[model samples]
Target chain A: MSTDPTANFSGDIAGDILTTALDWKNAGKGVALATVVTTWGSAPRPVGSQLAVDDEGKFIGSVSGGCIEGAVVTEALDAIADGKPRLLDFGVSDAQAWEVGLACGGKIQVYVERLDS
Target chain B: MKREILEQLQADRADKRPVVLATFLKTGEQRLLYLVGKKGLKDLDPRIGEAARAALIEDKPRTLDTEQGPLFLNVFNPPLRLILVGAVHIAQALVPMAQLAGYEVIVIDPRSAFGSVERFPGITLSNDWPDEAMAQLRPDLRTALVTLTHDPKIDDPALIAGLKSDVFYIGALGSKKTHASRLERLTAEGFGPDDFARIHGPVGLSIGAKSPAEISISILAQMTAALRQPAATPASSSAAA
Candidate 1:
């Protein structure tokens, strides 16, 4: 629900997120894009926040303010490998949230999909 | 997303066109919605079109639960623009501040002496008269205009153009008596009180700002308020006399 459309993600603008994904894809690397589709409570990153990942597990941008990016990157790597899209839901109540450290009492659903070659 | 769509989206943004990417969650299919002259996309579901219009207006992305399943509307709006009608000292201070706040700053002043590149480096400068410049700029919903020149020969025409456009904010720098005289002049030009109300006369919030830089801050703060809180009563109207 952030009003600012140009909100910074890891000091990168929204355009840069997609541009990076395009660049990685153009470089012949497997690429996946994760977007926060919905959120509840105090989600650090608002819905539409995006994170781009490559097959090497390198990531740009953020989905949860460094709280659950690691988990998202892992999911993105899987999506890239399988060329399959998946929706992931993370909440404070889930033990997986504790493992990935999304302990901010917020819930977010992230959609991870690979960039079609 | 397909590479062609990604490339198209990047080019649309580069051209400052407002667009929405409607992603169907179940199939990963996306429909790129380009707004056609303030109208909803043709042949689109009225419900989804209405939601996209709302998302563009609010400049926020959203998820809509439609009968077709969940769809995510990712809004891509052009960057905000700030057009300063005078390359005064305050304009010098305001340019960097506005850019930092995510606005593309442009200074318009026919006086080359004041609008010189040396005075405002790396900033867009226009030597054309205010009216002509505003005509070319076509101030829109995302544009904010400030008249810093104390000369009616310059500020007046700009104010007239700004009042006619849908610019989010219009601020003029002057005193109460000066603004009163300005209103009289504009009134003679067929502008009504409703139009006058749009101009933040005696510009900026009542911060008692003395320095040029402080005044710039007050003006930017007022612009931010007008942009972020359109429903709130303007604080400068009481001092607009």
Candidate 2:
């Protein structure tokens, strides 16, 4: 297997994430895609930002400024296992946000869905 | 998202097509909307189509409340483009600045001496005539055109092309008198007041700029304004340095 993160993908950042998800899925690895669908108050990442995760917990791209990727990755793994879509809300007010270190005081809603045929 | 839908979206993006993916947050259902060419929506909600078009024009992703549920309209607009009709000194300054602002800059000048590679190192240089180059480029909504060459032979064709196309910004560098005469000539060619109104003669903001670099800064600022705030009235064209 190629060690390059973008070995089979070539495009912009968003395109790369989608391409990676598809590539991982075709390779028989469970894949889930997480996208930042909405944001409020100084969110580091803009809406439509994406992250692609594999069942192995390997990931590419980001939905936050490295503040909530771990939690998102955990959700992505569960999504891949259950083949169920999930909407994750992370904000400064949420207790889960403190655990996930979303210390930027901004809020983001991420949509995580397993890539299905 | 389904594998086929993802593939189609990737294919559209690869082809530089402006597409919007509207996804229902509750059901994870997705529908692709194309800004140009064939209509992709059939038996779908018209409100979704309207919102998709609005999102495309705004060049931003947005969430819309719908009868079904909240829909996320993810806009995938092609990268912004800046086409310079003249590879003049101002263009030499503007090209790098526009590139830094995330515009894919293309310098078009038929004159081999003026549009040489040494003058615009690591830039896309086109020696085709302004009219020919504009036709080939087919400036779209995400593109901006500027005519920097004072010569009517070069700038006029470019200005005409810019007026005919969907380019968001059309700027020409000249004095007020020159602009008047240029407008007169264009008017003689059957262009109306609305077409002339679209051209930003004496291009650039009313910054007291005399040097080529400063003038480039002003022009880029005007382009940024035209892009980000499309609804706002453009700055008056009288204050050209």
Candidate 3:
């Protein structure tokens, strides 16, 4: 909070995590991305937020509860290899927006895509 | 490695995504303690010569802004999104709720009247049909799809497609009887019993809520709990890296 109000956050690649991942793909590095679009009450995060994964399953963002990111990373690699994108879901239970833990009883939906360059 | 991760953090945080900072606290043979949230909240006490412990939290962790600058262990979301299959009253409420929660929400409906930018303000509204919209929006496990139309015509295809896909949570608004009817139609359309189980029919918890606003709150609350559970755990060693 000084001469630059934007100084608190990102310096580079802040606005384009998607592009960075795509750049990785363009550079011959396998890349996968996941996004949290919808969530229920008490969700820790919001919509349009993204997470990226390289061929190595290392992640860059979050979707929901963080329980299913590993799963999405694996799926993203598969998508990258095949040039396809997949949509995935998770929750407290198969019923009543129950994913796991998270007593607020909210639900979130994420999309995992393997961006092509 | 820290610099590369910092580059990713710059991207995620610049867009104002919901990111949590997980710092290494203590380390053992197969575990690491962590501190979550903005650097303003705590003092970093990483043991210089020792391995660190990284505790976990579900708030989209990101490691940027510790006293030492960019430390590892921060995890952010990948273009997080919220896809609303039905553009109805509940969606009106859900939009702001989702935005406040840090999701990039998109409202999709076949009816242009319902899905107009004029009505939605700053949101990304789509006039495409729910099924086609789901395909276009690409809802996944990191996203939540809620069918608020209460009409099978709108939510049916979206639910069927969403259930089939890996979308994290699939919920549709309806009463018990309506949900039962929905199940029958989906089953006829080749949706299996297991697939039916994936949907939060009679969506939202049994909060005994009546108003659309309350129901919206209940529904969203359920979804938030679902996503945060997994963000709280990840061992640096003895775990998948």
| TM-score per candidate | 0.84, 0.91, 0.49
lDDT of predicted model 3: 0.58
lDDT of 3 by residue, B1-241 (tens): 1234444455445543434433322110011222323233334344411122221223332332344543333334334467787778878888898887767888888888888888799878888777777776666555777787876778788887788776666777777788879989988998877787667767776676667787777777766655654332111111010
Model 1 over residues A3-104: C-alpha lDDT tens digits? 444742222234488888998999999999999888999888888888999999998888999999999999999999888888899998888987888878
What would the per-residue lDDT of candidate 1 be over residues B92-170, giving only the tens digit for each residue? 8899999988888999999999999999999889999999999998777778999999899999999999999888899
lDDT string for model 2 (B1-241, tens) is 7888888988876776778988889888887898765477787778778889888887877899987899899887777889998888888889989988778899999999999999999988899998898888878888899998899999999889889988888988899999899999999988988887778888888889898898989889888888888777364642564
Clash pairs, candidate 2, are none
Model 1 docking grade: acceptable
Off by over 4 Å in 1: A1-5, A8-15, B35-40, B135-138, B160-165, B175-197, B207-210, B233-238
Candidate 3 residue-wise lDDT at B3:
35
Q: Label model 2 with its docking quality class.
A: acceptable
Q: Rank the candidates by DockQ, best first.
A: 1, 2, 3
Off by over 4 Å in 3: A1-117, B2-76, B230-241
What's the residue-level lDDT of A92 in candidate 3? 64
Task: Estimate, for each residue in A11-61, the C-alpha lDDT of model 2 and write its tens digit.
Answer: 364547777888888899888999888888988888888899999999999
User: Candidates' DockQ values?
Assistant: 0.44, 0.42, 0.03
RMSD of 2: 4.6
